[model samples]
Target chain A: MGHYWQEISALTMRWVRRLSREKFSMLFTLVQPMLFWLIFFGNLFQRAADTQVMQAPNYISFLAAGVVVMTVLNNGLAGGVDLLFDKENGFLERLMSTPIHRTSVILSRFIFVMAITSMQVLVILGVAYLFGVQPATGILGVAMILLIGMMFGVGLTAISMAMAFSVKSHGDFFSVLGFLSLPMIFLSSALVPLTAMPGWMSVLAQFNPMTWAIDAVRPLILSGWTEALPHVGMVVLVMIVFDALCLYGGAKAFRRAMG
Target chain B: MDRTIAIDVSHLSKTYDSYRAVDDLSFQVYAGEIFGLLGPNGAGKSTTLRTLITLLHPTSGTATVMGHDTVRDADKVRTLIGYVPQERAIDRFLTGREHLQLLGALYHLTKEEAAKRIAELLKLVELEAHADRPAKTYSGGMKRKLDIACGLLPDPKVLFLDEPTLGLDVQSRLRIWEYVRMLKARGMTIVMTTNYLDEADQLCDRLAIIDGGKIKTLGSPVELKIALGGDIVSLTLKETGRISSLESDLTGRPAIKTVRATPKGLDIRVESPEKALPAILESANRLGCNIEFIQYNRPRLDDVFIAHTGRAITESIPESETV
Candidate 1:
């Protein structure tokens, strides 16, 4: 466990170094999703107030849960790209050649990416707060939302890393980003309520881990976690399943890649 | 067992499909020695190094670094060895100090140890002035220097430098050579690979002439040159089409040991270039082939490459093997 912590700290240091240089570019990745939240959530909730879909006074508060989840998910999925890039650049080769444990390299990325997601959620939430979006609950609710988001991020990142090794994508950064981001955002409850969707879509939302994460934190952020245990439990269950599947995929892909 | 051997490999082999990249290749690099792998492209120089660094597992064989097994004990071996790859591995986003410190932490150094080592490495690579600058802003030489510093972070026992001066200017290349020598002076064991004949000649204490996944010969560079018999007097046929045919005309000459035509010209390595040049000139005119130029110089590592692999080192790599 101490070794694991060492790897995590080292990995976080590398990310900070990398992000620190592309200082302005990182803002683009962090801010672009929030902009979507503002433009889509602010206008959509205003239109939905007359409809039966939005029961809350300000739908943007309900929307904050989704924004937090999506931000964490996208960041986590792309966090896998860090490992992919290292593989491409021969950094992984350099590391592998050293005395460092193979598992440490993979674990470090997982820990660091989760940390980064935590920070990113804070930044996004701060922005949302400025737009008059506030969680009705205290610090614990916010921490629960971020923790659940981190869990989802880990699962998504594992899968992306698996894909990165199995198939080499030639598309540039934004192309890959656009290819992955929109489908995931639409499929989950990030944009609309699960009940607002058709019966089939609600079933899909139940299976979508993003939907579980949003539903887990939405009531907690708007009403409080005392009322959101069921959603939180569901999210936790989905995360465990997804984490296992993704870790399996990542490990298999890693064997094939390292060979 | 006493750390006398910096590297030891027994029956090391790696194969890709029917093509064998390294075929039961084996050799040893002793402590505080600058050992060289001398070969042309496709001679499996990189493959051998990759295996030692635990980047690739040997298909069959045992490789140990500083008495640590490269395969079964890869994690421990990884911490003990510093590998400088053929290509650059610096992260452009990080400054020199940050990059070294990050990698230092990965090696599990304490905070104070990491800081001290980062400062020491930056100074060792002569990048102390540029330590705080982002690597993206560094010049090619500066980047390479910083990269070498990053490799030295853990105070590794055995350092693997694969083609260190590959694409740099002459001055920077020499600078790298000087640094490697300095490391050796400090009692660091180093293994280096190079296709350049002169680099190996100037630096390697002992070298293995690798070709076609096999070690054709291994010895000190001077001894290898002497074993290669003195000088190479190469004949360039005026007509390129007849280059291959010239070999048949000059096959049984007493002065010439071997004759072959490469992309460069007709290369002939022989025992006595003084006698072979006169006979070669007489034979070329007799065969109705005009000689463009005939130059005789002492046998270089390039001739050793040709003698071993029958291939030139500088020929562009095929598209599939570009990386």
Candidate 2:
């Protein structure tokens, strides 16, 4: 068990170090969503500051949580790109040839993705704070935001990794990414509130896991724990179920791949 | 030398959907000897190796590494073997030292033990000076050396090297040969695969030449060469018209066993090139076929392959097709 933990940490550090070495890419991944919220969405919804439709003092504050979750969504969903490349380059084959604990490979990937997701969440929140959008739950709100990101991120990362093995090539994986990325983002309340969306789309958002995460996070940033904690608890439950299913399938796919 | 078998793969078969990659393959690699799987691309060399290494499950059959069944006791087999895959597996971001340490940790080596072993391996592969640099900066040879070091980190009893020197230059290939020799000296059992005939000829103590998912022949290089019975006497005819008559004349001679015609010449296998030379020339002269060129050569692994398969082991497959 001790050896297992050490191997996991070692492999996790490998991913972390690889990401850190590419400073520009790491920074870009964290900053891309923040840029969208601050420059594009912030200006696009500048008039929403005077509107009562938004629950915050400024649109950026309301959009802040959404941007944080988006980072998690994008980064976590694309986490398996590394796995795909590793498989293609035969690096994964080499790793499997060793006598080490096999689960450590997938576990370390999850840890690495979560670690990056956490950093991206921080960056988006920090950038939003710089734009004068303060979370009503304060520093504790930052923790809540991270919790929301991770809860949502783990399930997505697991599915991504699973798909990385199940799919035939990068083209197939990218198509799935393309097909799912927009729907998950737009179908959720990332760019708009459920009330603002049409009746049919709003109904769809209700079932989208992204909506539950955004709904859970929005209250902490805009309203407070009074509104957020209940949703957070519910999202945690949903994520537990979601992660169990995804990780089980991911492990199955991983075993087939190793064989 | 321990004559005990380090690896015994019996009637191993691996199939993928409709394609059978390996078929009823049986071979034993003795401990501390460098055994080669000689074959062209797609001949199941990698599949057989993968099955033994537990990377791929065999559709049917059993392989034992140091007496542990590969399928049932895969973990035990893994602990006893290290594999250097055909493809280069080094991460570009990690320095050579980091790669070695990471593998060491995977094998559950202590930090002190990993460090000491990494130092020793770095020296063994002659990459000590470049061990701290990122592997991406190293030349092709350095990357391959680091890969070998990674495989050796566990100090396994058997090491599987799949096409270890495939894309290396002559000098780098020779350097790897030295490393292989050194490993053999230290009593490590090594199994390597290659499509290069000369590589198998020079490196392996014994080789199994696989073609079309079966071992065409298996023996030491010298033994296989000797199995061909005699030297190959090649004669280039000036005119192609009388070649058939000359071939018939040589075929009837007691000294010649087989005759084959190439685009440039005719090759006649004889028990003794020196003894058969006079009869071969006399037969050609009697048939009025002018001999443009004549040469006597020892039988090679290639000849052995041609003898069994009726075709030369061609080396013209481009790299892209290998994937």
Candidate 3:
């Protein structure tokens, strides 16, 4: 049991070290969401998006939650590219031939991806603060937003990791990633609220776990604890079920690939 | 040499769907000897090593390492073996020191033990000066050395090297051979696979020549060569059409044991080349076969491969599509 955690920590630290060395990827990961989505897109749609419909003082404040969840979504979805590279380069095969616990490989990836997602989420929130968008629920609400983002991230990362193991190559994994992420972002209340969408699109958005996550976090940023708490419970429930399914499928894929 | 067995594989077969990558193969590797699996690509050499290392389970039959079953006691088997695959497995982002540290941790080495071992391996592979640099900056030979260092992190009893010197330059190949020899001197059992005939002849204590997922022959390099009987007299005829006539004429000669026709020549095995040479020349002259070149020397591993498989080891066998 002790060896299990030690192996996980060692593997996790490898990911952290690799990320730290990639100056461009690290800088891009933290800055892209703030520059394009938050500042440019937020200002572009600022006057057009009605504050009353968005249920906030301004579009920037409403878009903060969307950006946070979207960062988590993007980070979570692309989490497995490193593992895929390892598989191709024969690093994973080297790891498997060792005496370490098999589950350590999967668990270490989860821990590393979530840690990076949290850092990105914090950076997005800090940038949104520059736009005069403060969380109405204060520091605890900031914590809750990160919590919700992580909850949403768990299932997405699981699915991504599964695809990393299941697919033949990185190209195949990216194609599936693009197909899943674009439709998911458009279908949710990420860029636009559900009420403003066409009836069919709004109904589809209701089924997106990203919608549940964004809805839960939007209230925390725009409304106080009382309004946000109920939405948090529903999102938490949805994430638990979502994560269970993803993890189950991911385990199966891992077993097949490992064999 | 101690005769205790380190690895025992019996009737081990691994199949992917209908394709049998490893046919019903069996062999044993004794402790503290460098055993070679000599074969071309896709001859099931890598597959066999992977199975013994517990990376792949045998489809049928069984393999044991240090008395632990490969499938059932895989964890125990892993603790006793280290594998250096053909592919370079180093992380481009991590320094040489970091790669060893991480692998040491995974092998469950204590902090101090890992540090000591890592330092030793770095020096052994002569990467101490460049240990702080990421692998991407290292040359191909350096990357391969780091890979070997990682595999040695666990201080395993047996080391499995899959084509260890496969694309290395002559200097790098010699360095790797020195390291492998040094390991064998420490009484570590080593199993390596290679398609290089010279590598097998120079390094292997005993080797199995495999082809099409089967062991065609097995013995020490010298033994396999000497088994072909006397010296080899290679005669390349100027006229290709006269090779068969010359071969037939040379067959009944007194000192000649076997006469095999080659692409451009006839390879004649003679009990004594000194006596057979003159007679062979007479036969060629009688047959009116114009000789382009003639040479005689002791048999080599390539000749042994030819004797067994009816083709030289250097002859390209179309690689199997399945990995």
Q: In DockQ terms, which candidate is top?
A: 3
How well is each residue in A82-149 modelled by candidate 2, as lDDT tens digits? 99988987788778877778788888998999988897778777787788877889898888789878
Which model is ahead, 1 or 3, in terms of DockQ? 3
lDDT score for candidate 1 against the true structure: 0.80
Our model 2 lands, by Cα RMSD against the true structure, at: 4.5
Better of 1 and 2 by TM-score: 2
Which residue pairs come into collision in candidate 3? none
lDDT of 1 at B259: 83
lDDT of 1 by residue, B1-323 (tens): 45488789999998887678899988988999999998777779999999988878888998998898987888888878888877788788878887777777678888898888787777778888888888889998988887788778878888889889888999999999999999999999999999888999899999998876889989987777768776777776678877767787777788788887776467787777678888888877777888788777887777676666566677654656423
- Cα error of candidate 3 at position A138, Å: 2.1
Candidate 3: where are CA atoms >4 Å away?
B228-230, B234-294, B306-323
| Full ranking by lDDT | 3, 2, 1
Two-way TM-score contest, 1 vs 3, winner = 3
Of 1 and 2, the candidate ranking higher by lDDT: 2
Model 2 ranges with Cα > 4 A deviation: A48-50, B233-294, B315-323
Q: By the TM-score metric, which is better: model 2 or model 3? A: 3
lDDT of 2 by residue, B226-294 (tens): 788878888888998777777777785787879987776688888867678988887777778888888
